[model samples]
Target: MSTNTENTNAATKRVSPTGLDLDKLTDWLAAEHPGMVAGELSATLITGGKSNLTYELTDGTNAWIVRRPPLGTIMATAHDMRREYTMADALRGTDVPVAKMYAYCGDKDVLGADFYIMERIDGVPYRYADELRALGEERTRGLSTELVGTLAKLHSVDPAQVGLGDFGRPEGFLGRQVKRWKQQLDTSKTRELPGVEELHAKLLATVPAKSAAGIVHGDFRLDNVLMGPDDLPAAVIDWEMATLGDPLLDLALMLTYQRRAKIVAGYETTDPANYDVTLAPGYLSTEEIMALYEAESGRKLEGFGFHLGLACFKLAGISEGVRYRHINRQTVGEGFEDSGSTVPLLIELGLESLKEHK
Candidate 1:
């Protein structure tokens, strides 16, 4: 059976699709593009991509990436191709790095699921802490700075420039986030867990007092930032989570200070090869990342405390959702050995964040 993916961001979900039993991918390619004689499709099973099935494809000489919803019952409506396409299209002339889209296939008849193909961007994803450390001090510093800078550029982009104004519900965004995730977690309840409710209440009481809504990389973490030859960020992938909202919350999601404290997943490093991402000693501090926004975007850095708290809350809910999958026997791959302790650690992290921001 195919693996199930955990939901880590609001609105964007990782799910394995159902009845995708088509080896006809080659036939479709051949007929659609005429001269392009597509042969046997090679699916390089890329793991750690909990929600999407990413296949690195090659049509004889040319390479492309195929992405489809994971196999299973997904909660939301049809996949948001409009949103994903928007980010890739918008990044065309911007400083932010994104894959150049080749074509988007919405006809589920072709592949038993809707999928898209984009020119494969080359770079390695890190799976080990040591690998991040091994990038050496110099490369790691550059990697960290560039990663932060890429996010800064993403937030600074003019939504009007890319015709993406119809993306999200901007007003009262922070106010609704707490309740939104709380309801999701509640509905997916497989266990009677405590402190989850309390965490939501604490977060709702302190939504960010101010926000600079922009093109937010909803899941801007080290893993999402693509690293080039010398550990420099090539492009940020996984735009299913991208939205227009408070950019600082996006920053905090990347840090994931809370999720680290509380454990989830079979192992922290799914792939040991390139998972080592070192946060440089002088990389943008929480305060500095926010300050840079103030100077560049003209959005005051007020209620930063609230944003930090919300980030922690979001991570906790995400981890808990993954934990729920494990309990229900719906998760793929392996289960964590230290789950008993992991859940508590996450709750504590959420509570600690609340106190810090308060």
Candidate 2:
């Protein structure tokens, strides 16, 4: 039988979704964080996450977010709840807005995997252009500005000052990142992808010298952040891929997403309905974004072309992994139907990005 069929059959025997054990979780929380729950605990899966599983928990009087690893086999270092919790807790008093962390449970017996809980911030994670279009150009521009500014603010903080000095090794970060993503790509590959191996080889050959180390959000993008009513970033969620590394990598990844948004929106086509949020009127152009970051952080971005090329490679690997999961029926929620189609396009974009760099 296909993996999807096996997974579907397996799910039928389970009480809750893959990684959640609602009743046991409720009991554990009551014992550990008494009075935190006022009634019976219930959970609803929160979609839009492509890595770790996120669930919205409620006790009728309160709401919380629970994050844990996805079901089935996973990379050991990837979906670490402790890492996410530590970073969020460390950034509490800093300028970076993060959800308030409540607890982290490493015992797998509690819910079949490690998990963490945090107070849910009230804001919207704007995923598409339709949401931003309703807000109009002015508000969308303001929101985009806040998004970029928030990232700069995050990179400005000293990791040592935030008690995350030992979080990750920054030395040789760029080289390791190249190898790491290449391995991820190999593991996720289901078929031969033209230009993907060539792009990987090019990225390895052109790894740039490491810049000063700072906290890098490995998957920085619009949908990853929660925007408040004032068009400002309320909280930067999804820190699972965060670590200390070259801050320029973070900037490049954000730009890559911006470029991908355009690609997904069909820049060559006149399909108005295909527009992405990044294509919304008044959103900052690529040049404007670079300038804004430079001005805000007072950091001259040297060797940025190399970083952008590598960003494309990294994102291509990520997209391929998502596509693999979707094909296996291991993905949660809607919108995954077209995920596999983006893989080849992203690989092609990665090659094109490197050519431009040369």
Candidate 3:
């Protein structure tokens, strides 16, 4: 997990990992994308992904990526392959860098769940602070600035112009988000978190008025962006949570992660899902990130504290879900063993953010 992730291209004679069938996948690709299979396919489950199951597929000649839901029970509304594929497909010609979507397979018979194929872009997702620090202060600063700029550019895009006007209902997005996360937490609840109810109540009471409607990369963080050799974001992957919503929510989440990144770096902790590269020596500060986003997008942030609180609440809900899966033996990859410990801290952070902002 974290910066330790790398796609190993070494050819191996092995069976497909859990939740994927290489032979069936080859058949589907040959039918859907004719002549793309080339030879017998091999797939390795890509690590560092905490939510969706990502696999790097190769047919001895070409390499592609397949994204699907994790094996075992998943939330009905979560892990939408079509939604992820649609967002990336729509953003092809936009300033937001996304991988090239080749095809989408919605039939459950093909992969036991909806899935999509996209051309693998050779880019590095720097997940740890040290990995970014290794790039030296100047390069790290530039990459971090580009990361913020890419998000601002994403917020500047008009969803209607990109054929994603109806991607999500922005009219009551904030309210629905609070309620949705509460419901999500309910479904994944395993233990009584002390501050969960208080955080939920605070978020529900402090819903911010919508500012601007645009694409919200629901999970906007350094690890989610793939950096090319030139220190620019080559592609923004993991759009399973992307949708039309208040763009400021994305900013708040990014800020919250940066704060957490600083804490992680300070404590020298190893929470893969929460690591952020912004804590590197020369990365942008939270204040600079907000100012740069406001300047680049021309959208002044209002009621940002509420957005930050909501972001923490949403993250708490998500972490609780991950904790639930880990306890039930349903999670994939490493670093999930510590998920249960973050929920209460996230809830506490949400409450504190609300109080401080208020």
Clash count of each predicted structure: 14, 0, 0
How does each model score on lDDT?
0.62, 0.82, 0.83
Structural similarity to truth (TM-score) of each candidate: 0.80, 0.92, 0.92
Ranking by TM-score: 3, 2, 1
* Model 2 misplaced regions, further than 4 Å: 1-18, 267-274, 355-358
**Worst lDDT window (10 residues) for model 3?**
1-10
Of candidates 2 and 1, the better by lDDT: 2
For residues 123-173, write the lDDT of model 1, one tens digit per residue. Answer: 876544566566566665566667667777888887877777867767777
- Candidate 3, overall lDDT? 0.83
lDDT of 3 at 81: 91
How far out, in Å, is residue 123 in model 1? Answer: 0.8
- Candidate 3, residue 197: Cα displacement in angstroms equals 0.7
Measured on C-alpha atoms, candidate 2 has an lDDT of 0.82
Q: How far is candidate 3 from the true structure (C-alpha RMSD, Å)?
A: 4.0
Rank by lDDT, highest first.
3, 2, 1
